[model samples]
Target: MKKLSFTTPTAQKIYNDYFNRVSRCTRTLPEDDQREIMMEVNSHIYEATLAATPQTEVDILVDALESFGAPEVVLQALVADKKVKQATRTFNPRHVIQALYLNISNGVGFVLFGVIYLLIVAFGTLIVFKLIYPQHTGLFIREGHSFAFGFISELPGGLTELLGNWFIPVVAVLMVVFYFLNTLLFRLLKRK
Candidate 1:
């Protein structure tokens, strides 16, 4: 990438420091991704500086950087986007978790996705609990109506264990359903 030239030392220092911050912000990405982001940001700043006919290098550069905003704030979307692409490509849980953390606040879709994931985890837990305490873990009925569906230490007088040995399979099917919902939501709500 071509370096921007500034007559004033302060302006030069500012430019260098800004790029340093950009490098830090993009450090977690792949090398090629890092270079692409750096180049794009450099291009924007350079264009902004060139378009303005300011009195001095410092003035022009300062205006450009100010319009560009701070690296951490401005580059978050770009970083989050690349992280999502990487996570999708790799199918790595760690990357997905990091991507979720980065973009969780951007929209309500991620929050819904998180809820579905939690439901899947809960179903998995139910399967384990059913194995550990078969008699106590299952759908419970009370007074001829469905009441609760989970493990309980003491069964109420009118409560009855409904699923029995079918609890594990039911929970497994629920896990699959939640997993599918999560997948569908991600596919629909993910940024292009």
Candidate 2:
């Protein structure tokens, strides 16, 4: 940050105080960007005070700072803009938590999405478990017995083998498609 000069000690002190508060508020921003903003604000202050030639320098400085608004208000605007810029950037823990909270709080869509996903995963897992444990392959309930592919009684083995071969790939494709769709939906919902 460049050192700013003022004709009076009171003006210099006031400018420094206001900028210090602004700097503190912008600490969450990138270092270079923060420096740039501080410099820009400082330049604006100097120009405004210098242009107001009829008033005392201290009075001009005070009026300029006041007109620019409080540091806290300026900081809030900057921070909000920064957050919007970062929204599409890489994810961080803070962003993840914020997303989860927003979705869960906004409506039942998030819960429904989660439940549907869980059910799909559970069905896929159950099939995998039956395939792995051949002896315990009771995935379906018949009139008085539990059996795998019981509906295809004449081709039980063939049906089970066919499902076992294709279930994993189908589930995998569904997962990828759902992931993309969910992400798209989330982004759309957030914009709303």
Q: What is the TM-score of each candidate against the true structure?
A: 0.71, 0.51
| Tens digit of per-residue lDDT, candidate 1, span 1-192 | 788878889999999999999999988777899999999999999899889985688888989999999999989999988987786677566777777888798789988877787777788988888889888899998989668998898877888888889889988988888777777777676643
Error of 2 at 81 (Å): 1.7
Highest TM-score among the candidates is held by which one? 1
Question: Number of clashing residue pairs in every model?
Answer: 0, 0
- In model 1, which range of ten residues has the least summed lDDT? 183-192
Candidate 1 residues lying further than 4 Å off, grouped into runs, are 1-20, 27-31, 43-63
